[model samples]
Target chain A: MTVTATAGQPAWTHSLFRSGWLDGSALNFFLEELNPAWSLVRPAVRIRQIIEETHDTRSFVFKPAWGFGRAIAGQHVGIGVDINGRRHERRYSISSAPARGLVTITVKREPNGKVSNHLHDRIKVGDRVFVSPPQGDFVLPSPAPQKLLLIAAGSGITPLMAQLRSLLSGRYSGSIVLLNYVRSQQDRIFGAALDELAERHPQLSVHWCLEKENAERFSASQLQQRVPDYAERFALLCGPAGFMQVVRQHWHEQTLDERLRFEYFGTPQPFKPDDKPAGVAAHIALARSGRSIVAEANQSALAALEAAGETPSYGCRMGICQSCRCRKVSGPVRNLLTGAVSHEPNEEIQLCISAAEDDLVLDY
Target chain B: MKKPHPSRALSPQEQDALAAELDALRDSVVADLGERDARYIRRIVRISRYSAVFGRIALMFGFVPLLWPLAVLALGVSKILENMEIGHNVMHGQYDWMNDPRLNSQTYEWDNVGTSDNWRKTHNFKHHTYTNILGLDDDLGYDITRITGAQRWNPGYLLQPAYNVVFALLFQWGVALQDMKLGRYVLGRRPLTEMFAKLRPIVRKSGFQLFKDYLFFPLLAGPNLLAVPIGNLIANGMRNVWTYSIIHCGHFPAGVRIYTRAECKNESRGHWYARQMNGSANIEGSRLLYILSGHLSHQIEHHLFPDIPAHRYPEMAPKVREICERYGQHYATGPFIRQFGSVIGKFFLYAVPNLQRRPRTA
Candidate 1:
């Protein structure tokens, strides 16, 4: 049946009617109230199961309520929760492949981490948690490379596991090697899964470098010994800052940086000095709020504003995301990321990364 | 210059101490902020949208006659709730920490014809800052009514009763025009270019609203187009009247005091708190009534904790009232009908110069 637009009726009229107008709109509203996962902003998911990987680390499997688009292997999603009346968000890599019909996020509880500790201690099966649709560019490249090397340490095995699972499932015709580093055998995540996959697939090789047990560190020689043609492989790395730094140096020295991909879970901690620049306090004037706050040389504008009980909109809390960008109406600011001092008036700066170097006015 | 009534005066040290105490109250509330507030607003938003859409659809069947009144009533309630409970508090930055762009105070635009940007400047900053001080708060008489005796009496006020009725009928339009400062334009205090720039959004919003009600939905009804437009008119009129009554009761009740610039000179935080309490009145009602009023029923609490989510006001009101009592201040509150009646009475009373003696201080 050919359907044509009726006279005096716009093209959208039929679609609007088919969409059920008020009933359709009401259905969406009702579903959203029932669970935010039905909405576009931040769809929610329920924790289906929790698997303990280590004393401090666990994997949470989730079943999203609705409209959770597929995430490519090695991507991450932002997880948010309300704890004691405050909403906190943190991004975690998906550990499960898209074909799994569920998503899993492996988390290692940090002593001072708010969202991580909350997920570890408070979250339980059947509890709903809000999550942004999967995002991040850390996914495996299109047209898979002929050779691949996956290196991970601590809780960083998550995204690599996803890639490994997907590659194995896709029957990837490539030489694949996984070098997993942990404190001990007990600390290794997905140990049995890796062993099973290696045993089943002749092209897949698995190596565990137990730092405490074997007293071994990741080096180019060690990597070469296991995967002789390591130089010809596309490498993926994830781990603690120290481990990642060492691996980065190794890749740089070998001129393999072009073939290497990595992702950081959080912003790198700035090196601290015994004493901050003495008497270098800069006054940050919030123009809209008509208030001035003192920002020490060690503090970012965001930290200073937060300390002064001012809430400025922010997300990611990292320079990579521009959510915290604000107009710097006046004065000097030092970009913590670029290590460049800017005195340009009326320039926009990310509050999360810019430190007040001189008296600054911000359109907060 | 007039001073604060001697009975209400406090030493500088006392004022600072009281201000610190009030600050502590605000700090405590801020610290206690959480998901419940977010959930409360989200629920209201969902309900408002559902009802509004349902009302519009019901009006499509306006030819049925019986459904028209129900549709208009539903639409009116939905619009009122959206403007008051959701839009007002959200735009106050109460839920800004949620980081949802739709609910951000700096970004949220209400369903009303009043532009959110203008409302933020006029209502959020100016009115909240000035409360009921005569010259500073243009809301004292909406620059038109003669509800406060402090406002200069003129022959123009003799027509106040007629104007008051007209104002009530078109309260939303008046609010839209309020920020435009039409009086300033007429008096040549504001430039024509600036006035038009300010009027641009107002005109655009009003045009869209008119099209949605008088044109789009009505035309969608086809043979019932006339009935749908009439239904829209009734709905808008109902919303205006209801909003006007609630708003007037909040500030114009008999016991609610209006302040002068001289009385509030160099006002400390504690003094500001006192003025807010004196300037605003609350309507006592059931939970349903409170919800219907968009929690404006707790206007005194709203004035004090303007940035806190309005849903939390009822729980906070008693504590705020206790603090006021401890400071020997009056927290005006009464039933809705009594408050509305008192406001109407005050409107008539202030129409002419007071035959009664003026306060000695003034």
Candidate 2:
């Protein structure tokens, strides 16, 4: 299903121009001006179609630019969109089967989400969006497991849908039990598609859990009763934090954690200093200015710096603009958005969304 | 060079009022930044790049009478726009909201001999934070000439008039070397090994620049080797002298105030804004000159809002001037000739030693 498309460039010319005197900038400029889908470096894609998946969610089908590569099913890619002249990048899980020519990403509108709202309302077919190569290890493994269980809630159904379609389309011949929870049928993404898929596929079973109806809430005992062989199935979980927390606890209690894989979206809850023992505070060093300030475990590096009366240049206090991105010469910092703890030395970090986890030196 | 009459200093409450008003103006402009500002910068980039490419091509045929001068002019325009309107403003994080990697302050490399990394420290952080404070801001005279009486007069400065011409002609070289702290190394304060280590990046950057302008492009011209290199020299020379004049006018002009390091310690936001206003001068010019100067023509407004888009400085200037006037503050601005002439006048004035040790502040 993957296509190996390459932008034509003479190897000798590329090597010759690779000298330090020239940058890809000039070529990138002309390429972007001629057609947004053309670029020397970034993988720019054009929106081929917009699919209305639900009342609140829409799926965009993208035709990759020249030299585009294939993405694995059940993986996420960072999509860059220009809204109000400012470029904002957000990671979206691919919601389509891994195939050549086109890729689809389902976006759910969030009230305060700038990029999401633009994707939902302003963006149209044919607009170009810059995309990062598909990433994340939440995809189905090679030698697909037999008797799989996929649990998704609300918009979380996107990635699971990809995996489900990929599995049904000759990747796996095993049975898959899909558990999808939504507020109502109106909010259920891919409701009709799931129904059609279930009707055509004999080994696939789809369950719809609507919170608006008097459907019983998911429980460990209920799951055991519903599927007697649940412990034997490799399970993929995606939902709100509370739902995932409940499932995680149940799996941990049963010592079946090895069989369960989960992914959550949206702004991650910051590390709670109150939950941790004392002495979790971080010391932040401004390398160029030769100043140091202590950041409480609860505060972001930017907040701590501002509180200490240092005016580091910043814009859009959120991580969207990357204006406050600085070099972290050394330290551990937890990204407030993705909840990823970075321990890499001399890495670039956004001060607005990163909370220092230890003594940190920044090239500020 | 006669000093202008000092304006009345404001109290803390008055200063706070001025800051709040100016801050609100800045907020309004920031809120309104959108497609127009983004388009403006991109257009400038396009024009700059096109000019550079076309100029080089034209210079390949520079043996023709009309093409030589026109090619050099175009190339000069390209370099000026790249360094000033584009590179300088973008390095201030002005277009960071656009989120384009090409315009990102920390990562952007300009068509200059100076490395952008060195500039982020020497210019963006130090020069800005300590605008006109003697012994703090390296830009006070770029550690070469004494612009302010606050700096101790040394015997080396007696040849400043001659050095000023050389510095202006090779202005970019001076800026590129500013962060190297060559003086300290020469004075035995800095180690030779450390200085050489720092020189590596500068050498690499300058090497590529020299190669592109002098050797590579000219060689690529095939038969027009001599003409192309001469065109590049003219272009680079034009940019150097022009930038030198514009920058000197904005900073070292007569009537511009200078401060001491002690005077700026623990400075309040209002006082800082006040200092930036006092320490900088502006040149009245046409729209073309404004763009050519990267809107550094509105140097007072630029110093106040270093992070704001330079294109917006023109709009912000009158409002800034009004605020200064209401606060009984001096807003220095004049025609380019007058301002630049005063800057030249200071070269001679400070070349001879300040015989009497006056108060530390100027």
Candidate 3:
């Protein structure tokens, strides 16, 4: 997000800040006490309402603070909250329409999720939260497709729900099919809203795949029976990794990958040391400091660096804060949180949650 | 010179037990850190920042007689709060767990002329790691004053009492210059080019401070230029002297110990804790005074757990004293005047020669 010097201030005030005679951060520091929502640069939002969508899920509606920019529906926004005395940030897809002045995010509490559980238990209406500008590539395609197939499972319905709300509220003339999967009736989110919309709009079709009711699992035959034009329509899929993996493989086998877009939900399970062979070590080289350290397969990069007498800045030790995020110049590293092996060069990784997969080079 | 009195020694087993107990205390406190700690620091930041803004705005109306002194006092309090309570503690990574970018140790820049980077190196790492170790800790005498009797007496030290006044008046500049190690440059050890390279960031940082207080803000006060700049100067001087006394009282009080490098080598965790307890003294005062001093009044607790939040020092202080009592370790503490008086006494007592010696070893 651009922090243009006090946007509505006099031209001279902008120049004053630009000239370094006045500091924007210092001004923001003073103003934050008066109103947590007020900031010179950073975007902040105040919780205005909360909606219980399910037994385990709730939707938070936020009013943007002054200087907070607009967020498009279907895009993800990073919401930061202080749990205990520490701040933790997590990204969630905006579940509200861009036309709405208030932004909403639907969150499902995960058993082991620090941020999700904190938001569900501790956050209240009128509390302030820091927000990142709207992000992610999961947004709806421009010049809306004539025939759209939307698939979601569990909490993955958030972004697709937003796309559906935005599209249905507007003058877009299109045939939309929404397939929502849940475990039981109580597990379904936005059930009433989706039903109301489907009844009001003739072009919209709502399909509920309740697993507890022994409904047929998603398959080629079932998809074909539900939507005869599914192969010809653009599809957006979001679900648990397992569900998406199956659907993705099916689409790839059919060479229909280009017609489908997908996003993953649910936490990636943490790495277990027992999975690795004992006595294996990864060599990590610091590019700037020219120091090399050896880390065991179970050791986080932060721990290894500290053991080598390097004082890298870190917070929470867990991957909650991005404070320890630094550039990985080369080689592979496994995210301890998800056990996902990342081979991308020159990408930023959190030192606290990353274990060297092999010989690695880092920009310290 | 008179050396510090040696205390009762502990067995290696006793030292290990001491380490475990202190470690337990630290862990318990850390586990309990939550909204209360975050709120305390945020309140301090709010008070410091608001005071600064209000003080500067008040200085703009410096033409009013009563507002001038009040503005200067406000600015002085603001500077003390920022430098001591907020800046010093945060730069020690005390509030880093909060994960607020503003409170981060690595990037926090205070209102002082000293750059945070320099302070982190010289103060946090060097001074803290070698609290009272001679030659190794730059803060032993700040490379200027003969703070402890461990140092050899010199004719130069005769003027230390006189220079100590000037040093207090310009403590921030003294701290900013500490990392430069200018003594080497003076003695023709460090090359002028190398010194200049190290001097660049300091000059840039202090230059901004100078311009802001003396020129920029004064210019903004169109009619009452003299009062604004003058008020700013006195405000800065107040902070310098106040911090100097607080720091000096903590480190250089009469009963504080000074260790030789040989004696401190390869020390264990508990041994290090013992050394810190011996080397630091605490000032007793009301809660407000502790806040104003940035909780440095509990210097013993701070030395033990530098990264722990300072406001937690009070609650931890009584427990720490109890531990010290059980262990038979001297936990030095007294009222502010008594502590400051002892520090002042050390200034004169350490300046002259005293033929006395004490044998010690690690």
- Which candidate leads in TM-score? 2
| TM-score of the first chain alone, every candidate | 0.70, 0.75, 0.74
Q: Write the per-residue lDDT of candidate 3 for residues B188-208, one digit (tens) a residue.
A: 997999999998888877888
Per-residue accuracy of model 2 over A102-218 as CA lDDT, tens digit each: 888998887777777878878888787887667767877788898899988878888899999888987578989998889886988999999999999989999888878746568
* Tens-digit lDDT track of model 3 for A1-364: 0000011122342344434345655876657656766755344677899999999999999876654557666777767777677766667778888863788889989877777788888889977777755666776779889999999988989999889999999998999999888888898899999999999998999999888886658888888888788888899998888899889998899899999998766422223224445565677778777777778877899999999899998654654334566767666899774566876444557799899988777877
lDDT of 1 by residue, A92-147 (tens): 88888876378888888877777788898899998888776677678778888989
Clashing pairs in 1: A37-A44, A85-B34
Model 2 over residues B1-362: C-alpha lDDT tens digits? 33555777778898788878887888789779999999999999999999998899999998788988999999999999999999999988888767666677766778889887777777777777778888888898889988877778898888998998999999999999998879899999989999999998899889998998999999999999899988998899899999999999878987788887777777777888899899999999899999999999999999888878999999999999999998989999999999988988888888888867676553
State the local distance difference test value for candidate 1: 0.76
What are the TM-scores, per candidate, against the unseen true structure? 0.77, 0.86, 0.83
Model 2, runs deviating above 4 Å: A1-21, A40-43, A66-68, A270-364, B1-5, B355-362
Candidate 2 docking category? acceptable
Compute the lDDT of residue A223 as modeled in candidate 1: 77
CA lDDT scores, all candidates in order: 0.76, 0.81, 0.80
- Model 1's number of clashes is 2
Mark the 10 consecutive residues where model 1 chain B has the least summed lDDT: B1-10
